[model samples]
Target: MTGGNWLGLSGKTIVVTGGSGGIGRAILRGALDAGARVVVLDYDAKTAEETAREADSAGCLAIGLGCDVSDTDSVAAAAEAVAERWGGCDVLINNAGILRPGPLEDLSLEDWTRMLDVNLNGCLIGSQIFGKQMVERGGGAIVHVASISASQPQPFSGAYSPGKAAVAMLSRQLAYEWGPKRIRSNVISPGLVLTPLSEAFYKDEDVRRARERLVPVGRIGRPQDMADVALFLASDRAAYVNGQEIVVDGGLSQTLMGTVPRPGYSG
Candidate 1:
């Protein structure tokens, strides 16, 4: 089939942040393939437009808009535009974020604030803007793209982990407050997913194998792995699911303790 057959997202309008490429693009494509009219919200208008065109070619209604999630006015304007065009969004994938890796001690205040602003505050802003519409319309879903780092902190990752941790909590808070209106919110925490930005790191055979070894599944994750979870969270299939985080890390979290040397076990 030409379109996605994963869910009943046909004709639904979805707004995805940072959909110009990588995991964000994968999510956008998944929604489009599922027959949803998508909006690619990104800081770069050109790349967003390019992505939109590609989706449109696949017989999906897609648009690109430049938006800074940290800026309320920018987000409001984007929301207004979406409302005017698609009558309002049915789903929102708050996937915009940045990973500024550095030691917490060496990280500048500006870096920390920026990470929080984009990763945490960005999700809140998108939810509030689109979620208001969802509430008024009587129901909708918000899926956040938090990282597995949220729960398992990594050294030298700076504020990235902290910001994602807040995102997970933010999603839960929104779910608690918005569930009354039938608006569901959830978080998808991914681990070691291969994306455009990080593809180069995996080019080395040893590096790739080493990374894959860390996952109990014996392989790394793909963007589609996270996208599939996001689509499920946004669809009716997960109607009862809310205020929760679905870890898409190939059981890596489960093996954390096992990786440590045990008294009776041989390494």
Candidate 2:
């Protein structure tokens, strides 16, 4: 996408966690296309800087910093860097996350804690740190990239679902507590997206088709799909959209009834 000022983000400073790749990278690119100065925070410093350099080639002002969102000191440093470079953050996208698959019966405490640290605690930490910048700047928007598993249980995914579920609630709590401070918080729950992390699953044509059949849209989601929504949520266009969870699942969540045995109603 070409850089433009259509979303009124021309001079805005947008910070995206996990911005080195996948949906996070997409959001970073989208923000850049909208003419916003973007910061990429990822656990891998080199990868983050590479992504930033790529964006720079497109004439966008972007910087990549190593950050472990689960760590307060790491996040605080990243926030400070943003403040030093851009003065303050206008938008923050909490997109860094991890998944550890294991049955609940056999799940280890370490795995559970790790999942929560990244998926749940990371969100809070990022919000609190950058949120202060927003408070000082008068107001800002926060867009969290949660999973559809937040509402529906995905068995064998250890603490992935529970952690995400908490993130949804956390978003609401932040919205309520910070709305008065002009800090709007919202979440985007995505389903079946094809990214570097999930590319192995889609490599199998049969599995890919089977998954696609389950979605009403007849295809899996792309990073751009999530990025488009993030762009809107972070932009002033969605100023009134707060404490809300937008499910970008290609209408799959609404198809649960199709699995039930409804005999005489064949259309």
Candidate 3:
């Protein structure tokens, strides 16, 4: 795998939602590094600016866009902008998601809906809008960022897990419907990556070690780890890898850690 590149997306236009997030930025960087034009759609303008600047410095065409993937009108406008600016993207990476962590007992309906709005519905809307264009232009690729929580359970994972699980199923449905048009769809479930979202837990050495023990990989996931897989799924190299949910969490999912939370002990 190290001997050569996965696939070249040169001359391709890509749209990366939540491009400002930890893994989102990494995916954008990977695609841009591959000489592809990327449109970064992020909710936070500041973070989006940073991503766009980095891509621009790399001499790649990257547009920083503010978009609310949950809102119909918002997504419509964002998609329009992407189509207008890039004349349609060849790849659409739905990486935008929010984690509202709270005990199921204390969680509110508003919290649950918000999580679904951005995580599941957002991607669904993006797929419909962008997939139409891709289908018209012959074909395209869509890689969604799901979570191991979708399959495995974590404490206080109520909304996040269910929402992500829905996203995985959504990808499967989209794949089935869009495959005839050569529009491939896939999902990536990443485990405990050291991202801004998860940095609080890792900030404490003891906590970090405890978290690592839970992952059979002996360490938490990395942004680049997910990015590498994403690059493959988005490129022509993964043309045959459609409707598949590739869990890129090292060997964490394979290990059964049991009910008790044990620190510094990798199964």
User: In TM-score terms, which candidate is top?
Assistant: 2
The CA lDDT of each predicted structure is: 0.89, 0.92, 0.85
What C-alpha RMSD separates each model from the true structure?
Answer: 1.8, 1.5, 3.2
CA lDDT of 129 in candidate 1?
91
lDDT of 3 at 163: 88
Provide the clash count, candidate 1. Answer: 1
lDDT per residue for candidate 3 within 149-169, as digits (tens), equals 998766796588888888899
Pick out the ten consecutive residues of candidate 2 with the lowest summed lDDT: 1-10
Return model 3's CA RMSD, one decimal: 3.2
Q: Candidate 1, residue 111: CA error in Å?
A: 0.7
Q: Count the backbone clashes (under 3 Å) in each candidate.
A: 1, 0, 0
Q: Return the top candidate by lDDT.
A: 2
Residue-wise C-alpha lDDT for candidate 2, range 131-202, written one tens digit per residue: 999999999999999989999899999999999999999999999999999999999999999999999999
Deviation of model 3 at 172, angstroms: 0.6
